[model samples]
Target: MITDPARLLVYESDGLTAYRTAPRAVVLPATTEEVVAVMKLLHAEGIPVVPRGAGTGLSGGALASPGAVILGTSRMNRILSLDPENRLARLQPGVVNTRLSDAARPHGLYYAPDPSSQTTCTIGGNVAENSGGPHCLKYGVTSRYVVGLTVVLADGEVVVLGGAGADPY
Candidate 1:
């Protein structure tokens, strides 16, 4: 957690520079459990939480609301698992979209989204925006490739949605 104004200023905006707002604080949780813990505290205190992923969002989605807490996902980057046979990958929301394809190359698999900012934009941001790129003409956006998600609700409840199998219903 960071309360220093100077440090917090760094997260005032995402890639989009037109809009900006300094967060009351910035928290970079390294794991989902840590994120949940932080959310629990924030919820109890009634502080708003803004989730950020690499700050590569072109829409200013990473920009914090006034007095809100910026929850940066950069430190949480990690490719947790890959199943080539099932054509699925499970990962931390902070994982860069391109990195997933790079790691899966050896398995003759690749995540299809190719947003211009793929090298830096994170999966979480992609999901949040339902982003698309050049390849989207052929493969569509993040939602098409995302088979499952582990979401931490505002109240700090963890919910797993979907699965590796085709029927992620």
Candidate 2:
């Protein structure tokens, strides 16, 4: 069983302070295989699932339900790759918003979008809602940065969204 004294409560309320539930179990899977396995298990039981990142959500999107599986990706943070020539940075979904930009600082490049919760919001959640920021009008939103996504459905079916190229959708 997943354990973390405050995991449950934090799941319910991260970004939004008023509405919170915290979760019964909080899993931090470091790889795609682990994420798929847990999702498949939870899906088999037909349980509610809430995928979370930095817990800095303000829209109550990360709040947990009565009987839900809260998947926090904080532990999966990592920088997978970086291409200086192409001016691109590849990182895990759990990577922090500021972390990405911080890494890009010396390269004379940076992530275009800078949300208020950049310091705490995870890249996973940013991908979920296709986040936006003040510079999006010109720099574009999170959707522009994501070249692809490795997603696992409820039934343990893994799917790859987008591939290397110009099409990010």
Candidate 3:
């Protein structure tokens, strides 16, 4: 957790610099369990949580509200699994977008969503924004490539949505 005003300034705004709001604090959890615990505590106290990923969103979606805590996913970066044969990748929310393609390149595969900020933006942010670049006209957007999501609700309830083999309903 970051409470110092100086440190907090770094998270005051994302790529969209037009708007800025200093959060009460910032918490960067490094694991799923950690995120759940933080959410549980915040929920009990009635504090709002603003999820942020790499702070590169131009849509202003990552902006923190007054008295809210910035839940940054930057520390939870890792490629948990990459299955080239199955064309599936299990990654931590903080994994940078380009990193996924670089990893898959060895297997002659790549993550298709190529947002302009792909070099610095995290995949989680891309998912939230449904971001895309020039390639989207041909390959579609982020939602098309996303098959599953492990989400932690505001109340701290963890749920798995969709799956690798499940039909899109």
Candidate 4:
């Protein structure tokens, strides 16, 4: 948790500089358990949580509301699994967009979404924004590539939605 004002300044706004809000604090959780614990505590206290990826979103979706806690996923970065045979990957939300492609390149496969900020932006942010870039003209948006999601709801209930061969509902 980051309560120091100086450190908190870095999270005041994302790529969208027009708007800024100082969160009450910032919490960077490095694992699913950590995230769940944080969410549970915040939910029990009636506090709001604003999820943040790499802070590269131009949509300002990561802006923290007053008294909200910035739940940053930066520390949870890792490419959990990559299977060239099935053309599948299991990655932590904080994995940078380009990193996925780089990892896949050796297998002659690449993640299709190529947003301008791909070098710095996160896959999690892309999912949230349904982001698309130059390649989208042919490959479509982020939704087309997403296979599954493990989401922590507002009340701290964890839900797994979609999967490799299952319908996304």
Of the candidates numbered 1 and 2, which has the greater lDDT value? 1
RMSD in order of candidates: 1.4, 1.9, 1.0, 1.3
| Deviating ranges (above 4 Å) for candidate 2 | 1-7
Write the number of the candidate with greater TM-score, choosing between 1 and 2: 1
* Global lDDT of each candidate: 0.87, 0.80, 0.93, 0.91
Q: How close is candidate 2 to the true structure, as a TM-score?
A: 0.90
- Preferred candidate (lDDT higher): 1 or 4: 4
The order of the candidates by TM-score, greatest first, is: 3, 4, 1, 2
Tens-digit lDDT track of model 1 for 1-169: 8999888877998888888899999999999999999999999999999999888778888888878999988888888888788888888988998899899999998888888898988998899988899979887887888777889999999998877755632
Candidate 4 lDDT over residue span 97-168, tens digit each: 999999999999998999889999898888989989998999899998888999988887889988777653
lDDT digits (tens) for residues 48-153 of candidate 3: 9999998888888999999999999999899999999989999989999999999999999998989888999998898899988899999888888888999999
Clashes of each: 0, 5, 0, 0
Candidate 1, lDDT over the whole model: 0.87
Highest-scoring model, lDDT: 3
**Where does candidate 2 clash, by residue pair?**
8-22, 8-23, 9-22, 12-21, 12-22
Q: What is the lDDT of residue 15 in candidate 4?
A: 95
- Residues 20-40 of candidate 2 have per-residue lDDT tens digits of 675768887888899889998
Whose TM-score is greatest here? 3
Q: Rank order by lDDT, top first?
A: 3, 4, 1, 2
- TM-score of each prediction: 0.95, 0.90, 0.97, 0.96
